[model samples]
Target: MTATQPAAEAPETAGETFDSLNPATDEVVGTYPVHTREEVEAAVERAREAARWWASLGFDGRAERLRRWKGVLTRRLAQLCTVVRDETGKPVADAQLESVLGIEHIAWAGKHARKVLGKQRRASGLLMANQAATVEYQPLGVVGVIGPWNYPVFTPLGSITYALAAGNAVVFKPSEYTPGVGKWLVEAFEQVVPEAPVLQLITGFGETGAALTKAGVDKIAFTGSTATGKKIMAAAAETLTPVVIEAGGKDPVLVDADADLDAAADATVWGAFSNSGQTCVGVERVYVHERVHDEFVAKVVEKSKDVRGGSDAAAQYGPMTMPSQLAVVRRHITDALARGGKALIGGVDAVGDRFAQPTVLVDVPEDSEAVREETFGPTVTIAKVRDMDEAVDKANATRYGLGSTVFSKRRGVELAQRLRTGMTAINAPLSFTGIASLPFGGVGDSGFGRIHGPEGLREFARSKAIARQRYTAPIALTTFTRKEKTDALVAKLITVLHGKR
Candidate 1:
């Protein structure tokens, strides 16, 4: 949430505290303060002051500081990965991959902010040819970031890095499941920019997040479930604060008849099961052309045979980071199997207390719970389509349009363009996420607003346009002293130029 008025004074201390637990072991990872609304108000007030000093540094100064902070993250990458693994139960390699992607966003935001948000000349219309026009993006002062636990580093930094680069101080509220990672990031940032509290951390459960919305920041960048996004929006409306929501997605993949069967199978398996299929953009439903449907299914099942989920080095993935999600996953799987779906890999039995194996279903109805709602687990459903046209129609039928993939040797780009998603990958799985130059977001129920590339830099900024007269016009239409003849001439000019069109 963004602030519109001065913040209230804060209390001396928060009322209570909470602990972060490891999902796999159910052990305490760390304990953090449960900040109250008053405490949240204090953080925002301090951030408001810090934003002023940060904005004064200008683009070059801010970029230099951000690069130094990036260096800290790069040098201590392994240590950070360990923290992520412990809290989220993800494999260390997966944690490192996400962190590395976050580092890329930092580099991109630092290197490109000046060029993207700096003032630039613009062409004045023919009617105002005597005036010079220019536009520049200014920071929104203080930004509030509510981060998600999955890919905690990469997803949140997509917003945090851009907000910082656009010259605003950020107040981050990491999910209760991943507070240590957030603390580590904020601490690293402080080491590089110790002059002020440019980045602040608030940790706790739903109450803390609710406090943040009422704390009166300039804008809020949230990444989580669609239900939570709606709540954030409703809270932000009280102050008319702007928000950017990157919510959950029941993404789909389209396999055209021309697609490479082996490649499509490998991509689908990896995209659907990676990170134990907890990824917001991970593939939940796959649409295969009838010609290669049997081949693709066989290949996917073969590839998924060795993929296991456990908290160990040898395991391909790790346990479910959120324990409660196991029931939801189980319910979806049970419903699918009961509704005439056949499991190609794991089934309802695969879902355990801590982890769930990759479950692939075929012959599932399009209206089943597994297909229509977000399972948010290591599960996917495959459906055969008569042609590419049918495949696309089935893919677009869902309410979510966050991310999608198209596997076609020839029609990759064409098919990708037709999907109503924020980002798409052609002939590959989740490739758009690694590219720093592309913007990442979603549409419809998946939530809206972007947080990468030029669009991201502008998300935390307010555009200001300026026009100034360079010289006096021969005919002064704007002046009060303009003659009736001049007005008649202006009307005649408009008629000659625009009347026919």
Candidate 2:
């Protein structure tokens, strides 16, 4: 994934800078400073002070500021989308969709933070009836956010919005490929919160991100490849700083025998080819029941015929955001063909210099690189399964379990629940990502912790438990004055309450 790799490196000398280019034409979009470790530490220190004031605003006050920020994003939506497209080489419409989704998340986080993290009463249990137990999620002060280039606006804000809502100041380190987008976002936030730098932007290569992990931030929220996520975890471990890693995913799509073949085919094509298959949750593999495998493949190939990658107005998608990924896509296609896979649509020739035409493969071995690795390109491998059971098994075989999709009217939810992934979309492509209330993360190699919904807000917070003594108990078990009879009475109570179960 490009998230884990540095798009470009700057010189180590002071005052060095780098340029962000449009992958389509190699045109310089913008130039940004290569923030050094010293600069990163300085930003963290500034965030520390800002965090105090930001948290003091309380949920309601902070929410108001966020609302204003949301308005800025909405009003300037087209501008940000242009910046996104210029840097990422994605279509303007795709960039707009990404920005709109990011705005929705900001609104949701701001509106619901109080209800999710504010102090709330907790059950005290029978033995502690006289005490009032309460718990609240408190801010972790400052947070370091290492964002990815793909879906730069939406993916990074998944962490930034939630962290801010949880009352933490954020220092975002966007990918070097899309520093212009990052700068735009930070400037928008500054318009609303001019008093303090609640959200800051630091642009550079992987070293800047590494600096953030060790900068003494309370927690680090990273979105990238599992390989890079591991390196970040190791760096964060030096200071025992906590982290929430949203890593790479080789997501799958399952098409059942009784599924709506048309709908499944449409979803598979869009999920695999949209954003040129740069999405972390995009479908990379498909498992279809033998009964409908041929029909489904035909529909997918037919539907994919019109989908092309280019910079033209009619193009469905755009070129590869990172030039290096072009080789990986070609390698996967070449390896699949070598292992007896048949290309139903575009083949190795589809991978051009900047753009990769949508490619669909069949009869591919399950252990092939195209099936097992994170291709992260506009390519998908379709495999036949005897039944839905095999479909589920094959889908769950990958080390990366980030997301999955199912197309079965009757077993949509059933099969979705059985998949070893963090999220699933039933008869839809990337549906979980649009819902602000749903938590998004993955198990196993996809990385740990969450970055959306209430879980996301809590990820940047620490739970503070409080038990207030409202009145003295007749028999205080916690007190040194407790009698042996009290212990006997507690044992009897426990037996009566739980022994039956």
Candidate 3:
């Protein structure tokens, strides 16, 4: 596709072809380019050359280019939003919001990359006082990013912006369902740096993602379901390439009895059904203090009924981006209901072809797969806990720890910190993505290696420490001249510093 054209289809150079079908209606939304191994290798080779030039620009020059790119996005905001809407089957407002967030991230990354990645002087130990030690971050040549269908813009930009600001060229393989969004981003970058393909796009299915992992890129950044993330890590291992996986999450939100029922209800509704519940950090489970459990559930049910999904203007959201996700969502809702669970809002039939209506299940057993696994649909399982301690225990029981939230007046921060996840927001859902300074990632099965903030900058660059002796010392142990006393002194210092009291 040309820069002037809407990225309705992936470029022909990528070779294979696939279709993006609307989940609401089983119609072909558009066709996408399927990249092969050969094309991926070529793209990586081109990115390597682009990386050198981009790196040579230094931090300041790159920041300027990034700023210009941001301006381009800001100017053509409408056009970009249209592509996102077309490719992902989301509402135009949702598309605009996603793009706006991506622009913010790019701006933040560009403005802060130098401060986060530049050289810094470090302290030399007393024994090595003569040595001047400094540490600097260097780029990792090229990065291959495999993005997911949900939150295509925000999710991929988390990696893309950081990698670009850190001086590495990126070859992004957006989810087949949202290639247009990916293409739009790359085209906008060309407005500021048109000399080379510093940021390129490749679209295909799992095979293409596999090709990218094995295509000799320095690192891989992937965002998808946990099962798929595991497969990606396994593939990356074959080449010994480092990877950052933003896998799926069964994120839970807890509400204490003292919390405001109205606020908790509002948060739960938006958190569970936003984007048709396709978010990686979307709230999939809820544990309310028994004191307010009944009130919270009724309020949430009432609020959810007002939230609708369709291809209309007043609808809160649009259809699901992918068709296959419908089956998974259905299976989970069914399993929960079959295990003596009750649906306060939607039941098994909520899974529609193009959109899964908001589903809030209660009385689901903890051991049920619906409770333990990730259900990346517009669904949630609400349960009551006797107190905060039980809520904490249940929240931390999951293997996946990505993000969590707490709605408590007195113990918000303390409770948030206790959760075994990379990030938690007090009385907010997915706020960490907005604060560009805080590290955003997951742990255990949720995946690792931050993609935003300082942690993100360091993730794309390697540390290079340099220590030089400013002057020769009197005790030159390495020279082997009169070193007996020096060796004894070194032994004594080690014993004094390291020995048990």
Top-lDDT structure, candidate number: 2
Clashing pairs in 1: 2-217, 2-218, 3-217
Candidate 3 Cα misplacement greater than 4 A, ranges: 1-15, 26-29, 492-501
- Clash pairs (backbone) in predicted model 2: none
lDDT of 2 by residue, 174-204 (tens): 9999999998998888878877777888889
Name the TM-score of candidate 3. Answer: 0.95
Per-residue lDDT of 439-458 in model 1, one digit per residue for the tens? 99999989999999999999
lDDT scores in order: 0.91, 0.92, 0.87
Which runs of model 1 end up more than 4 angstroms from their true locations? 1-14
- Weakest 10 consecutive residues of candidate 3 by summed lDDT: 1-10
Candidate 2 has its poorest 10 consecutive residues by lDDT at: 1-10
> To one decimal, what is the Cα RMSD in angstroms of model 3 from the true structure?
3.2
